[model samples]
Target chain A: MAFATKRLGKELTKLHGSLPPGIELVSAEGFEEWLLDIKVLDANPLYLNQTYRLKFKFSPSYPIEPPEVTFVNTKDRPIPMHPHIYSNGIICLDLLGSQGWTPIQNVESICMSLQSMLTGNTKNERPEGDQLFVANNRRRPRDIDFYYHDNTV
Target chain B: MVNAEQPPDPVRALEFKEKGNKCFQAGDYQGAEGFYTQAISHDPTNPLLYTNRAMALLKLSHYESVISDSLTALSLHPNNMKAHFQLAQAQIALHHEKDALESAKKAYELCMEEVMHGGKGATSLGPIMELVRRCRKEVWEGRERERTRTEKGLLGELVRDLEDRRDVEVQRLEGESAGEIQIEEVRQEYEGKIESLRGVFHRAGEVPRRRVPDWCIDDITFAVMDDPVVTKTGQSYDRSSIMEHLKRSPTDPLTREPLHVSDLRPNLALREACEEFLEENGWAVDW
Candidate 1:
């Protein structure tokens, strides 16, 4: 109840208000995890009018540390095709990574950043080694050794 | 301390001056100095501006800066009692006895004239009069030592004047600040009455006692625990709840890190905090 549930409770209360466009909170039933839906507003042909779901797994460190954020592919949600996104829905964005995350960036900002990332992208393919990494990778998204040489995304 | 980034606007400068006043009232002398500097830059000719900044500098114990600001204020408006009083105070603080005596005498004379004219300068008159008496005593003592070495006559008239001034100053200061003491006493009495009313309401069960924040409680049991333990990742849980989780899985319930029963350290600080909270709020045990 210290950092995990207490912080998530406040975040959940904030998410109930009107959010920025294209980022909608789907479910936040518990303090551990939350599901959010984000859409690229502009007519980017790769993700034109397509909605994507993001799954956020928050550790107890929470805002002091970054929440674990990745795309969740379900029956209704599909992972957007980007060079940074893997086929298994793991995104390799630096903001979700350890080195680039800041405590001030909240759930809504993360969703908007993801939405903007998709909107500005022109690529229709996943990361270069999507299939190989998706098949063998068992590490958590935070633990993954992501090479963030690509800043254009 | 003036922020050079914003373009100069007198209206904005006034706003900043008001902000400086608020900061001064809140005892943020450094912040008030910064704001006052900004205000002075926008309205440089205002004598009161320098006087206001001098007050903040005085509280910060910047004796030299206060003296400089008070000099500037006095140069612009020679009749300013505040700047004179502040100059006297700063000089005295810096142990410039002769200069302090001169400034205090001038301030006391001006303050007395203002008070005689039915002006609102009585608030400052009392303190300036006290400073005058102190400075005169210091100067007299310094001269008396020199006179003792030179075998000069003792100034009996000056000593009589000091005693007369002491009695008159004491009577006047008591009369003025007496109203303030009475108001303070009445305010304290009303505050006590209000506190008793609140206690009566509590006994009648009209108002509930305060509750602890959810963060301080155990998530599983939903109670304040005496023995709390923190995980390596910094999430604290009740010892019993975490022990039950550890028996099923050797990982933390939240972080899923490779935690063992041996890794769970007793949170001594949180345990003491919980005990203190319970001591004040015994009702929270049931809550």
Candidate 2:
């Protein structure tokens, strides 16, 4: 029987049609399973127009498991901001991790989610108190006691 | 005499990897897992094979097997960051937060170092960054939640192990004692521990909105909350319960293929409901 990587590549190739223009996945290697180059279509009011590249790696368990995603571009290409995103590109969303990972998930679905994760975001607000908060201390969007009031980002 | 140095038949291997990926995408982690195992058997030297297999195991929630696969991969290629990443995932699943954190840091450091030396670093950051954040959040801060859960889990395992050991010992003693009543007493002792350990897990979630349980597979919630019919012979449970049981361990009920939520499907109605739910909930839903 074949393994998960070949299947992922085939599925990803099939996804070329649905994927956003700026967000194209480059070649996936053994170490890096997913390579996404995102061209931010709409400029953020705070950071102005800037594009960024994102990367992803899936465990053999792709859809049934959440993929391992990260930001690859240097700080020169600033990442977008939202309540769950850290200055370091660490996303605090519940969808990607165990708190939110579902078995029905896949690469196309994750990319679509991330696209919306970026598109829906407008406030450019970093995780609360971004200036001082380290990656670990910032309360997860799921753990935060605060009721989610804003839908932006 | 034929010239050597042709890249081995990566086609079948590639196909195996693809099948594994398909199973994974379908949420059949167990199925994906078997495919990965087969893929690796076909191409035993590919570090990616182990990394992928380890991940499938993690999705199946088989942290022990995950750890083993990652360690094996790492042993083959010490500099392989994906191996480290998979190891970290297994560690996180096992609630070894400190180990997982360290493993992640090592993976990040290695990836950075590799790229600095003109090596292929995070050529793709989209998924990796998502995982980095997730690991940082879940493994770093989730340590507290994970520790509590781990302790209970360890306790449960200890009792189960002890019970099995005692059962064997007691059977041997019964043979020697020739129907002595002492076997009953020994059995009771082991049973008590198992009972108490189970109690701990039961009490763990008593707190309101307590940390998500480690044993709970978050991915299958959609199927569970949607249609839950009990299976008569454990052949296939209502999608949810079966998924839950599989999350506990993906032993195929029939063939033990390491099942996942993907291996099963909902009727068109349930499937439609899932899609509608994702849309309404604003979940990142895709085909």
Candidate 3:
């Protein structure tokens, strides 16, 4: 836990210096959780002129483990419609999954991946089982065993 | 020593220790120091009280007092990590670089021992390791300073020796047939030699621009590698970081292939390069 926090501290200092375009840090008040705001730079009709808020939760064994990332709904923010994104803000990306995650991935890299995932999407509908999963699912994003079969956006 | 007239009051000491902790958390180091002093008076045998006082004194930059209090705490409990850490901090502040490095290494060793035993102080290893690195850097800089001084003194002696030889040659040439020209040539030769030696020393004394090379940094820990090991994929990482990773997951962090701790080979060449870089730029430990 201390090692994770120290590494996060270094990452935070680097983030303060500069972040990639289309990705902005919302808040990083502690090592436990951070919020980031990302936007699709190109004029994708589905995600045009919209901002998405991402929440990242770090476990004690972070870097070795992937962060729990999910979208959050607010008054001004809405969950973007995508085939892999549910109405409840849960995302189905292999990069977020334990098997697909590697220590080399970082917060900024995650944000960029999400940004590109949004940019490449043409479908404006949620996952087929979105409504049911949103209603019945009680587990966190990291714990859910998502089968990553879909490669096309 | 306890006032033998009145028995030690452990309960009062606990109360005062709580007060000291509260004050220390609130950033009132003076108040914290006072409370810890009272706590120590109540329980003279408790090393925790002295450590608390030392921590407060450290915050207040009362380095000498911090050293004394930390020493007292260590005397009470020789393996107290906090006491050793504080003593190292105070020693570093006082520019006792060698002593600070020794104390910091002691703390780091104790932390590692605790980790090996599955004890309670595993969380403290990160900070203790960082302190050890800082102390090592300080000690290195101290030695560099001493080496520079010795080099300067040696350069002075060499220059004087050349000048003395030139004077003797000129004195001998004064009685020769072509005395003036030979004397001038002897002086010019010695002066050129002295100038070249000074140039060499000047270049040696110049401080190298501080930059940690990418090859020396471990991608896993994002730190300058002290002990680097090569993975099967040709990537290198700090040995401790890779071992820790292998403990949790038996896959290469980069290539995601099935990997084992036994698969790692010491990157002897890269390790030597990192060590050589650190010898000149010890501050890269923080990098």
Q: Compare the candidates by lDDT and give the number of the best one.
A: 3
* Model 3, docking class: acceptable
TM-score of each: 0.37, 0.34, 0.63
RMSD of each: 27.9, 25.0, 8.2
User: What would the per-residue lDDT of candidate 1 be over residues B71-148, giving only the tens digit for each residue?
Assistant: 999988998888988998999888787799789868866875675465766557546655764665565556545655
Worst 10 residues of 3 chain A by lDDT: A144-153
lDDT-wise, the better of 2 and 3 is 3
DockQ score of the complex predicted as candidate 1: 0.02
Stretches of candidate 1 off by over 4 Å are B1-287
* Residue B171 Cα positional deviation in candidate 2, in Å, after optimal superposition: 98
Q: Which ten residues in a row have the lowest lDDT in candidate 3 chain B?
A: B114-123
CA lDDT, candidate 3, residue B198 = 100
Give the range where candidate 2 chain B is weakest over 10 consecutive residues by summed lDDT.
B210-219
Residue-level lDDT of model 3, residues B1-287, one tens digit each, is 78877689989999999999999999999999999988888899999999999999999999999999999988989999889989999999999988998898788768766755667775576667777778878878888889989999999999999999988888777856555777788899999999999999999888877666788877776778766889889999986678677777788988889988678888999988987887778767774
Runs of candidate 2 with Cα error greater than 4 angstroms are A1-3, A16-18, A43-48, A131-153, B1-287
Q: Model-by-model lDDT, in order?
A: 0.75, 0.59, 0.86
**Which CAPRI category fits model 2?**
incorrect
User: Model 3 over residues A1-153: C-alpha lDDT tens digits?
Assistant: 866886787678778979999899899998999999999999999999999999999998888888999999987789989999989899999889888888768898999999999999999898877889999999988789886667767
Q: After superposition, how far is residue B60 of candidate 3 from its true place, in Å?
A: 1.3
